[model samples]
Target: MEVRRATVDDIDVMAHVLATVAEEGTLGTEPPVDLEVRGQRFRELIEGQGPSAMWVLEDGGRVLGNASVSETRTSGVLTLGMAILAEARGRGGGRRLLEAILEHARSQGAHKVELEAWTDNARAIALYVSTGFEVEGLRRNHYRRRDGSLRSTLLMAVLLDTSEPEPA
Candidate 1:
C-alpha cells in the first residue's frame, strides 16, 4: 500500500471509508450522514490552509484509510484522527497511516500528538499503545453511541520531541 497527502479527489472514497466505519458503530462518534455531505466537509478541509495535514492509504485504485493531525490553539499540541476500512484493519495500514501522520506533525514542529479512542475499542487502543501513545486520562461518558448509550473515552498522547521527557 502507498501513503500520500490527501487531495480533493480523495474525498469520495474517504467519505465512504468513514461512513462504513461509523455505520459499524466503531471508532468515530459522528453519526453517519449522506456521502455527498461527508465529501463536502472533506473538501473544505482539503482546501482550507489551516494548521492540519491529512493523508490517505491506497492500494491500486482503492482507498484503505485516512489519517490527519490538526494543531490546537494550545501551542505545540496537535490532535490526531484516523479511520481504516474494516477489511484493512489487521494488515498494518493503520500503523503505517499513523506513522506517516506523526512524522508530518513532527515536521510541522508539533511537540505532542493526542487522540481519543472509545474505551471499549480494544484493538484501536492496542494499536495506539503499540505505536508509542500512552493513556493520559479517561473521559467518562464523553461519547454517545448510535444506540443512545454513552461510552467513555481514553485520552492518549505521544510526545514527538523525544529530546526532552514529558512532564511528570
Candidate 2:
C-alpha cells in the first residue's frame, strides 16, 4: 500500500472507507451518515485550507484508510484522527498513518499532537502507547455506542521536541 497526501480527488473513496468503519462502530464518534454527505464534508475540509493536513493509504486504486491532524484553537496543539478499513487493520496501516501525521505536525511547527480513543479499544490504545503517546487522562462516558452503551475515552498526547537546529 502507498501512503501519500490526500487531495480532493480522493474524497469519495475516503468517505466510503470512513463510512464503512463508522457503521462498524469503531472509527468515529458520530453516527454513520449518507456516503454522499460525508464526501461533501470531506471536500469542504480539503478546501478549507486551515492548519491541517490529510493523508490516505491507497492500493490498487482503492483507498484503504485516512489520517488527519487539525489544529485546535489552543495554540501549538493539534488534534489527530485516523481510521483504517477493517480489512486493513493489524497490518501496520495505523502505525504508518500515525507516524506520518506526527511528522507532518512537527514540520508544521506543532508543539503537541493529541487524540482520543475509546477506552475499550485496546488495540488502538496500545498502538498509541507504542508510538510514544502518553495517556493524559480519561473522559468518563464520553462516547455512546450504536448499541446505546456509553464508553469512556482515553486522552492521549505526544509532545514534539522541536529545539534541535535544522539541517543546513
Candidate 3:
C-alpha cells in the first residue's frame, strides 16, 4: 500500500471510502453518507481552502482509505481523523496514514494532534497508543447515535512540542 498527499481528483474515492467505513459504525459518521457534500468538503481541503491537509492510502492504484488533520480552535493544535476500508485494516494502511499525518503535523509546526475514538474501538485505540498518543479523557455518553442510543468516546492526544518554555 502507498500513502500520498491527496488532490481534488481524489475526492470521489475518498468519499466512497468514508461512506464504506461509516457503514460499519466504527467511525463517527453514520451510514448513508452524502457523497456530494463530502466531495465538496474534500475538494476544499485538497484545494488548500482551509488549514488542513489530507492523504490517501492506495493499493494497486485504487484508494482504500484516507486520513486528515485540521487546525483546531486552539492555536498550534490539530484535530485528527482517519478511516480505512475494513478490507484494508491490519495491513499497515492505518499506520502508514498515521505516519503521514504525524509528519505533516510536525512539519507544519503543530504543538499537538488530537482525536476521538469510540470507547469500544480497541483496535483503533491500540494503534493510537502504539503511535505515541495517550488517552486524555473520556466523554461519557457524548454522542447520540442515529438509533437514539448514546455512545462514549475516548479523547486521545500526542504532544509534539518538546521544546523548552520561554523565560517569564
Candidate 4:
C-alpha cells in the first residue's frame, strides 16, 4: 500500500474510486458519474488549492483509493473527502486513506477535521465514528438518490490535538 500525492494523471482512477464508493455503479447501472467532471475537479484541487493536499493509494500501481483535505482558514478546520474502490472496502484501505489525510491536516495547522457523510451510509458513518469523528450537525436533503429521493447528510468532526491525546 503506497500512498502518494496525486497528479493529473490520476484522474481516471480517482473517478473510478469515487463512482464506486458513491454506489453510482450499482444503483443506476447507467452511466457512471461523469469522469471528466471528476477528473477536472481533482486536477484543480491538486494544482490550485491552498492548505490542501490530494493523495492516491496504489497497490501494484493500481489505485485503490483517493483522499483530499480542504482547509478552511476562517474556521481553522480542514474538511476531508475519501473514496475507496467498492471492492476494496473493509480491508483497511479507507482507514489508511483517512489516517494519511488526518496527518496532512495536522501539518496544515488544522486543530479540527471534518467530513460530510450521507446519513444512509451506515458503514461509512461507523467508520468515521470509529476514527474519532463526532456528528456535529445535519444537513437535510443534502443529496438526491437515484430514486429521486432526498437524503440527509451528517457533518462529522474530529479534533486533531497535536498537543494532547484526542478525546476518547
Candidate 5:
C-alpha cells in the first residue's frame, strides 16, 4: 500500500472509515461520537477555514484510511487524529498513515504531537506506544455516551526534536 497526503477528494471515504471504526468500540469500551457530525467535521477539516493537514492510505484507487495533524504555534503543539476502515484493521495501514503524519509534522517544525484515545482502546494505545508516543495522562470520563454514561480517555504524546532519531 502507498501512503500519501490526502486531497479534497478523500473526504467521503475518510469520513466513512472514521465513522465505522468509531462505532466498533475500541480497547474494552465503546464511546458515542456523532457519526454524522464527524463526517461533517472531516469535510470541514479538509476544506476547513483553519490550517490543517491530512494523509491517506491508497490501494486499488481508494482511500482506505486516514490520519491528520493540526498545529497551532500559540499552543506550541501539533494534534493528531486517525482511523482505518474496520475491515482494514490488523494491517499496517494505520502505521503508514501515522508515519506520514510524523514526517509532515517534522517538516512543519513541530515540537511535539499528541492525541486522545479512549482508555479502553488497548489496540490504539498499543499502536501509539509502539510508535513512540507515551501515555502522558488520563482524563476520567472524558466521553459521554448517548445515554449519558461516561468513558475515560488516555492522553498520548510523542516529542519531536532535532536531538532524537526518527522511528523506522
Candidate 6:
C-alpha cells in the first residue's frame, strides 16, 4: 500500500471509504454521506494553498482510506481525522497515514494536532497512543446519535512544539 498526498482524482474514493466506515458507527460522520459537499471540501483542501491538507492510502491504485488535518480555530493547532475501509484496518495503513499527517503538520509549523475518537474505539486509541498521542480528556455524552442515543469521545492530542522556552 502507498500513502501519498491526495489529489482531486481521489475525492470520490476518499468519500466512499468515509461513508463505508461511517456505516459501522465508528467514525463521527454518519452514513448517507453528502458526496457533493464532501467533494467540495476535499477540493478546497487539495486545490487551495493552505496548511490544511489530505492524504490517501491506496493499494493497486485503489484507495483504501484517507486522513486529513484541518486548521482549527486556535492558531497552530490542527484537528485530525481518518477513516479506513473495514477490511483495511489491521494492516499498518492507519499508522502510515498518521505519520504522513503528523509530518505535514510539523512542516506547516503546526504546534499541535488534536483528534476525537469514540470512547469504544480502543484499537484506534491504542494506535494514537503508540504514535505519541496522549489522552487529554473525555467528553461524556457529548454527541447525540441520529437514533437519539448519546456517544462520548476521548479527546487526544500530540504536541509538536516540545522545545524549551527561551530564558528571560
Model 1 has an lDDT value of: 0.83
Q: Write the per-residue lDDT of candidate 1 for residues 37-127, one digit (tens) a residue.
A: 8787677666766558778999897899998777656688988888888887798888898889788777878888998888889999999
| Model 5 stretches astray by more than 4 angstroms | 27-40, 47-51, 72-74, 162-168
- What's the distance in Å from true for residue 130, model 1? 1.2
Indicate which candidate wins on TM-score: 6
lDDT of each: 0.83, 0.83, 0.92, 0.78, 0.76, 0.91
Off by over 4 Å in 2: 145-147, 162-168
As a whole number from 0 to 100, the lDDT of residue 12 in candidate 6 is: 86
Ranking by TM-score: 6, 3, 1, 2, 4, 5
C-alpha root-mean-square deviation, each candidate = 2.0, 4.5, 2.1, 4.1, 4.8, 2.0
Clashes of each: 0, 0, 0, 0, 4, 0
Clashing pairs in 4: none
Q: What TM-scores do the predictions have?
A: 0.89, 0.87, 0.94, 0.81, 0.81, 0.95
RMSD of 6: 2.0
Model 6, runs deviating above 4 Å:
164-168
Candidate 3: tens digits of C-alpha lDDT, residues 1-168: 999999888999999999999998999989899999999878877776445989999999999999988876788898988999998899999999999999988888888999999999999999999999999999999999999999999999999986867688
Candidate 2: clashing pairs of residues: none
Model 5 error, position 117 (Å): 1.0
**Model 1 segments beyond 4 Å from truth?**
162-168
* Backbone clash total, candidate 5: 4
Q: For candidate 4, what's the RMSD?
A: 4.1
- With a 3 Å backbone cut-off (N, CA, C), the pairs that clash in candidate 5 are 27-120, 27-121, 27-122, 28-120
lDDT of 6 by residue, 19-137 (tens): 88888999899878898888898888888777889999999998999998888678899999899898888899999999999999999999899999999999999999999999999
